[model samples]
Target: MEQDLPPVLSLDIGGTKLAAGVVTGDGRIHGWQVTPTRREEGPRQVLARLFDLGRKAVADAGEPEVAAVGISCGGPLDTATGVLGCPPHLPGWIDVPVGALAAEAFGVPSALENDATAAALGEFRYGAGRGTRTMLYLTVSTGVGGGSVIGGRLHRGAAGNGGELGHVMVRPGGRRCTCGRHGCLEAYASGTAIAERAREALATGRPSSLAAVGNPTAEDVSRAVESGDGLAREIWDETTWALGTAITDLVNVFEPELVVLGGGVTRSGALLLDPVAVAVARDAMPPAARTARIVLAELGAGVCVVGAGAVAHDLLSGKTPGKTPHA
Candidate 1:
């Protein structure tokens, strides 16, 4: 395995599940496997399962050898040191050396990247942002994460957290965000935020179809909106507005040629995109607004895995940096 090599193993670690696969040069997944995180089992247990997932993926892919391992997970993680710091989403997972552990388990080198950054790379290499020198990617799921391709390269921030795009202010003082900040874009636009807003609306005894659906999730809200439920429509509208505002800010700062929006919330598709696009066009600085195209990511749920594979491929080829050897 070498850094110049083309294909590699990819793994995606989420608060809820773990996914792994062999990502080929063509960006296709071979022997993809996924399982719940079972956080109650603790970090060590979770990593054991996560490593098993890699073995399964490798066996399934039938590739006797893989050049490297690419791992994608949430932050605040130290990609340079391959240590996962205290990520708020994954409580109790403190200072875990995930990248080094994966390398040892698999007997190959590995590279670590924030899941969002990996997604950005995956999109840049194989998805909607392909061929673009400057691109932005956001995953609006349990939380909002941002990453960018600047100067045709993934912009690894000084701390190796990539970019904390979700922390950007959209509402200023509207809701409490997970980042201990008030009214961040994540507080208003993420799937969790959408469901929370809908639940709050229901708690107010608002007349809506959502009440009938117990424990309404973001998907429920989307359905309600489609069915003309005013409550659902209102929440959905606000979500899009927050996304628009935050993205507009990013556009003004990054001047990226393309903005790729992914994650569970993006399933709303044109409903979500059209408005955000309009806002950026209308509000972003003239030059940035002129060339920026806001679109959905093409990799879908398999993005993190493929992105990890790309990073692993890079590591094997020596294109990656900041990977410390495992003990």
Candidate 2:
């Protein structure tokens, strides 16, 4: 039995940041909460604090009422059962029943999702991919992860982990990725990968203007690229090239109406988007290339919260997953 459910509480658990908010059905965040994750605290301590953050969001929303809770965390997670199974981002956390825990805390139903998958849902419901029957969302942050909506439904695939789009091979024998794969898209184009390339160039005595930061981030590399630094341009070009190659494969396979790119690396803006878009347009199959529009995610940093809220909304509204929920 359910009364009109209250506003949904959405939580995003990231390696660097913890974001929680009360989200309404209209794709707006009511009371947003954010803090550093302090990941070394381990899943137990961090999760406790994360839960506390959720409470604060609910209180701040002043709604007296959040009908359900939605959690978006980095995967390898069990979206169907709401269990987080040994997420690489949350080292040592094995099969934690996060959804059930949230349900207990809030006295309401809870849903858990992969952060990338949640981001895709957010895009589908409210962002660049809105109204599209098929779309893809890729987040190129500390690690690259992506989710797809095919035939108007989130394609969970046979492995429940959604498709690991980031694992697509680009260079075949290039950089090693977190997933222990060489030449995966994540190895070449993620924000972490960009910084790594910059550091490697510096280590090899390549002349560049990026020596000042001691430990430059991806943004630093972008700044250097814009400043006409040869080394930086090399690294940036590699990043964009890898993105272009991988997205081309994706556009060909999924034939999505839109491909939404988000995450830290996307801050490079058109430097990244233009090349990837151009490559996809030139390399993908004509039908898919013609139909797909590569674009940046409109929700920005708030996507996880909104996406999780969307998940909870669907659950509360009885929109359970099936062969194709959106269809």
Which has the greatest lDDT?
Answer: 1
RMSD of each: 2.0, 4.0
Candidate 1 clashes between residue pairs 3 or more apart in a chain or in different chains: 2-316, 2-317, 3-316, 3-317, 3-318, 4-317
lDDT of 2 by residue, 1-327 (tens): 212445889999987899999988788898899999998888778889998999999999987988788899988888777888998887778898888778877778888888898888888887888789989999998888989988777777777777888999998888888888799999998888889888988998866889877888999999998889888988888888898899999988888889999988888899789888988899999998999899998999899999999888877776643111211
lDDT score at residue 21, model 1, on the 0-100 scale: 93
Model 1 has an lDDT value of 0.87
Taken over the whole model, the C-alpha lDDT of each candidate is 0.87, 0.86
Error of 1 at 255 (Å): 0.6
lDDT of 2: 0.86
Please name the candidate that would achieve the greatest TM-score relative to the true structure.
1
- Among all windows of 10 consecutive residues in model 1, the one with the lowest summed lDDT is 1-10
- In candidate 1, what are the lDDT values of residues 46-122, reduced to their tens digit? 99998889888989999887778889998888887788898776888889988888778877778888999999998
